[model samples]
Target: MESNSSNPYKDCLVNEERRLIDERTNVGTVEKKKIAIHMAQSNSDNHTKELDLGTKTPKPIQPILSAYPCTGLGKDRRCFQPQWYKSFTWIEYSITRNAIFCFPCRNFPTQPQKGYLFVIGYQKFRKVKEFLTAHGETNGHATNVILWNHFKQSLIEGTIKEKFVALTKSEIMPPGNAHYCSPPLQNQMLSAAGNIILKYIASEIREAGYFDVMADDTRDVSSYEQFCICVRYVDKTNTPKEFFISFEKVVDLNAESLTKTLISTLNNNSINAICVAQAYDGASVMKGHLSGVQEKYRKNHKMAIYAHCYAHKLNLVLISACKYLPQSRKTNIGENRASWRNFCQNHHSSENNDHIRSYKIPIDTLNIYL
Candidate 1:
């Protein structure tokens, strides 16, 4: 390990630092250096960079007045102490500048809204509360606070993925490059996270010993035959719990294919234990005697009892009754009128019905004269 003091390239580094060009030095050179720094910090391949915690918290607030050593004048020529400076979480007193700075605001730079508490030091003690209030209410400061709080919560929850996303969005990407974090990419990340959580829950269900499955298939908006699987089990609290496990797209809707898909899902999740029960809607493909999903599954696990869901049975009954029942529908105009009157009598005021009936009654010459 060569000492930096004795290194041969030490002068080259010092000269390089002096030669560094900025707006005050030369044209186009400072911009290039900044771009280099940004690129080095950026995650071009969808990877999260390591979090710089020092940048998030910045200068820690302390209570010792002597350590900060304020020198500015106060009422009656006394050394000033910032009234709003109570060693609050967001407050930090700068010893070099002899002024107060917002810790969270300086830690995460955003567009300043008011007097230069964040950029320039805030020293006006008389208006300290007013200035502090204004700085705290700024859009940029509020946003930073929310992001910082969310990051802290994620750390507490032990959610590394969420913490990574929060840190990347807040710190890694350069300011004003919001489009770099595309919506589609975010959705994909969320979906991946959901799959991980779902698998863990499925594992929990498998460990619960006895569970039942409820399955159903429907055509999604994209015209794909999507199968949904859910498991019901008694949880640790002795309460019945039901959780959705999977939504899979199937190429075929036959009894055999459906049964195979179900079996494959269960096996993949290591849920091969004997099923306590199974429930599905009454379709020939699902509930048939010899070749249906229930039959096939039952053959493999005899303890897995199959039942045609009673809810589906009731729905089918209602549809059949509407289709075949004669009294449920109007056969003629007179019958329709009678049905309307019957409905009004049952659902509306009987007094109003009687008044309507009285008006309908045939009034002779006496009523006409009156």
Candidate 2:
């Protein structure tokens, strides 16, 4: 539909098409369509973008406002004080709804309770302080608050206050009133927070009834062998999760010493009995069938089957495959179309290749993967 077309046939078709469309829907404007779509979507329980509490990624609007409208109500004239918004930063004021909503709970509700703060927003201006304070103190509220903080941490890799400053120096929170600015206090706070988070992860693992153990040893910058132990389990939602529980200096690298440390760590957490699997790199000290770390762990929990670390095997494979590469491919393949040439060579060389030729079955792939 080019404007002012010279061809009469084209002009006639365009005008006729426009007429039919206009007749079908008298108001075919984009604005009208948008309004209709919004009206249709408004009845559902789904939250619209406006009420998503700035949780959607790829940047979000600043939620904390400097001034919350004081909706004066009740006999003693109780209302939402604008100053309160400063103290309780998790609360968000809705202009359209004329209510305050819990920003954290709205996004990450810990329970299936139907609190107004989580969805429709809270408008009980009368006794607002009493209810708001009580809501803040709830375990669910605290959990969601922590979760919201964790979400913010994911969006920006920095301290909470630093995140605030980076986001816009938080409206309710002034820069001067910020506390725990000192390094020592920050370290202490971080340690306590880590312990709390670790406790929650450990509790979730134990609650899941069964879990797998993962341990690896690596040399730190100072050349000290650091033995790290972690656990992998499916959560209540059936989503797999791995949480690091311990990272300690390895005074001894012997299988017995490593077994003792690992066993003690699991016993302390009371998950040693329920351990269903243990994965470690193919090191003689760790995976040796005869009295190795795996054998020692299996002695206590026979159900805990041993597995060679997949990632470790992949690393070994990659290193071994590097030896098969041509010197031309191994050279500066990054520069001047070398990578492209190598990729083309590999692609053409693999043209007739089939999965049957590479691996007869899926179990074969798994066996090689292990």
Candidate 3:
């Protein structure tokens, strides 16, 4: 049984429902919000995105009244109604508890609710109409609504907020140059949409149970070393699928550093993937039997296999090629080899030998004549 003791919330309420839903669930708040909102259709990175379809929390999502359970004394039985949800926009239903609640009051009820009412839940559908209207008129509900509107305004208007009621009433976009169209708002929208997609993908991968990891590091034009992590798994149909999940900035190419960075990124995304295999080029830091990334990772997932793939190194070569292009040549990533001949020194020899030796060499980079 849940504790009858009520904990009053006194925080802002714009996007607060996400926190409430998560708190009601067992998972982390950020992760739960991502997966829940993931159901909303949003722009994909590969697509040529247009502004009109930008990410936005259009409205609050409540439960379907059709599924509401019924209860009451003889002949006066009642169930939640769709019209009530429509009339009281603040209405929310918890399928777990088999009851309806007020979205605002559930998190930040300012006044005491006798019999727990909407704060905990209000089940007497027979009296719901009378009680809901009266509750809405109370000072508690009005105060909570004020705070919610303020936070909502901050998100869309770059201020804490005070405008949900007004914004919902507006039909058209408030001109492109308006404060609502600011870059910070656009970036936040894009990030929110991206996190939603990432969390959804993470869920699918974890549900698949066993997976393989693929990773490689590269020096970006900004001189930052980034490790790109990918995962491959077979879905319920036994069909193989692969996804690029993250590109994390790392301190260096040390096996320990890479392992920590990779593990942290995976955990943050809530992807506790059971790695069955790991694929990477045969660099000592990646494939070394003593203490490489594969070995370190296997300490956590002992069953994982280390599979070397020559083609996996192609990703880094592509990054190297980008530096040679006319658009990028002007701003070069520093190199100290002096000349192409000196850069290729000691012999343009055997492929595997060069591969291992190149793995631990200086940071000046290779003889990329491309």
Candidate 4:
């Protein structure tokens, strides 16, 4: 018999496998269609039932519980509860007892007597009313005024003077070693505290071996000149730490004035120089060649070097670019002349309507002069 070179059995097996796969694929398609039809029928039935009942499906309910623990206060004062629950409990108690009073007189006893009027002055009453009005706590200014006046009259005659005496005593002998003083007096205390903090910061800086200084001035809403001085140094952990050593009030912001202010503030706080590096705003008075703050400091301290502020350099560059460049023209001579003309025209315009004007220049033109 001749040797069978072709694999007939293998070819037959491959044909059978292809046929089985096609049959299985058709079966899967049919099963999916049946499942889709069944789902549609079920949904239709549910919709019909809802229509007949004339009721919408109820939404899944969400829990209205909080994550924080709820607790009750006992005779022991040390027991703590969730902050929200405690606040709610106090509010409920106040409402039930009718103990809630205007913020200014909340601590006073209920049904204030005739002599209690002296404790709260007319100015304070007015201030409280104003505060309430500003904060939208009460409506009708006239009603607030009437209620405040009635409450005022209920106070005792000598109570105001007594309260003042109590306040003075509190200041002189604050409870628990904490300070108690009026805001103005508190400001004076803060100034003294700031001086102490500065001394501590300076001492820390000195111990650190060497440091750089960053100084700047800014105006507040009231246009008060405030100067900020900080020491930049790397701590033992090799991390950069900037300690704001002082915030001094300055009379003027000129270069000489600022330099004088800086020296005076540092000297008062006992911050001695050790290879000083001054960083300031790029204003002429601060960074200028002649009589600038850095120049003034250089005269006094030979080791003082002005660190050129990158931000200031960028700002100066942008300002110069805008001033010398004209609309649509970038060539230095043409742009400058155009800008000058536009500025002159805008300055002379009667209605200041020059903003609506535009200059024409070729878009394809490129000038290296700029």
TM-score against native, each model: 0.41, 0.45, 0.39, 0.38
List model 2 lDDT by residue over 268-363, tens digit each: 766633889999998898899997899988898889999999778756544443444444345553464664445333532443234224433232
lDDT values, one for every candidate:
0.61, 0.67, 0.63, 0.49
**Segments in model 2 whose C-alpha atoms lie over 4 Å from true places:** 1-179, 270-273, 326-370
Two-way lDDT contest, 1 vs 3, winner: 3
Please write out the lDDT profile of model 4 over residues 1-370, one tens digit for every residue: 9997743433343343335334554356665455445434432332233211111112111122344221111211121123423332211111111111232222232444211111211111112334334433433333534544545563633333344457577665444544434677667767777777877777876677666777888887788888987777765667777778767788887888888888887677666747467788767888886889898887877777887765555454334445544542455645476764554345335433233233222211211111
In angstroms, what RMSD does candidate 2 have relative to the true structure? 22.2
Q: Model 4 Cα displacement at 50 (Å)?
A: 44
Best-performing candidate as measured by TM-score: 2
Off by over 4 Å in 3: 1-181, 313-370
Ranking by lDDT: 2, 3, 1, 4
Q: List the residue pairs that clash in candidate 4.
A: 115-155, 115-156, 115-157, 116-155, 116-156, 117-155, 117-156, 118-160, 119-160
**Candidate with better lDDT, 2 vs 3:** 2
TM-score quality measure for candidate 1:
0.41
* Ordering by TM-score: 2, 1, 3, 4
Candidate 1, residues 1-370, lDDT tens digits: the string is 9665532223332333234323233336666566435422321211122222235542446345643443222221223364455534577665544556666666655554333455434533544576677768878878877666665775677454445547677566444434434778668867787778767767767677788888999999899999998878876667888888788899999998999989888787666555889999978889887888999988877888888785565455434434544554545536577754454345335664464355443222112211
